[model samples]
Target: MAEIVNLRQARKQKARDEKLRVAEQNRALHGRSKAERQRDRLIADKAEKFVASHRLDPSGKDEQ
Candidate 1:
């Protein structure tokens, strides 16, 4: 015995499944937690501060 599948419903279900797979991949690529985000932010802030400490610019350049 064979069951007839509704074409429209099957297509929609496949689309939904594909979307979930892609969303999962994205979550994996990006860190998935608050702690991870905070850690990255701290690293960036420290790097910026280090750069600023080593940087020098003419004060009048910004006024132009």
Candidate 2:
């Protein structure tokens, strides 16, 4: 004997699972806190400054 299956319930369950997967992806993309964002920005700024300080000028004159 074959088991009875409900097509409507199966469709709804599939939709719910798809929604959950999209929500999880969205959270990963935009889930950073304000402090975390600021910290990342600060680190990037510091790195840029460090790189600039180490760069040499194209002209013969050197500025420290």
Candidate 3:
């Protein structure tokens, strides 16, 4: 026999989950403008170069 669920609680949980999902989607859509994306890309590129400059050499020959 299957356990019984409280219908009202189940409905409320479903509603809450749906609301959270919609809010997340809306946030992503309106979160960043084009200029923001460009700025993020620039910042990320700079960070990458900074980290790469401090890295050790690969020191292994390719097996190709």
Candidate 4:
């Protein structure tokens, strides 16, 4: 005798597996660690400050 499987249960299980697969793929592509995000933010802030410091004043005069 051969074993029998339920079609509905099989379909639901397949769907769940497919959903998990896509979730994992998305996480690999878009997920970032908190430390990584913080480091990138710090780098951006430093670059912005450097540019602002080097920018020339159009009026050629310091404003109080």
Which prediction has more favorable lDDT, 1 or 2?
2
Clashing pairs in 4: none
List where candidate 1 sits over 4 angstroms from the true fold: 47-64
Candidate 1 Cα deviation (angstroms), residue 6: 0.6
Give lDDT tens digits, candidate 1, residues 1-64. 8999999999999999999999999988974699888998999999988877776753324544
**Candidate 2 positional error at 57, Å:** 1.3
Give the number of the best model, judged by lDDT: 4
Candidate 2, superposed: residue stretches over 4 Å from native? 1-10, 58-64
Q: Report the Cα lDDT for residue 61, model 1.
A: 46
- Angstrom error at residue 19, model 3: 0.3
* Superior by lDDT: candidate 2 or candidate 4: 4
lDDT of 4 by residue, 14-42 (tens): 99999999999999998999999999999
lDDT of 2 by residue, 1-64 (tens): 9989899999999999999999999999999999999999999999988877777864546777
Task: Indicate which candidate wins on TM-score.
Answer: 4
Angstrom error of the Cα, residue 21, model 4: value is 1.0
Q: Which model, 3 or 4, shows the larger lDDT?
A: 4
Q: Rank candidates, lDDT, best first.
A: 4, 2, 3, 1
Summed backbone clashes in each candidate are: 0, 0, 0, 0
Off by over 4 Å in 3: 33-64
Lowest-scoring 10 consecutive residues by lDDT in candidate 2?
52-61
How many residue-pair clashes does candidate 2 contain?
Answer: 0
Model 3, span 1-64: residue lDDT tens: 9999999999999999999999999998888888999999999999988877776655334555
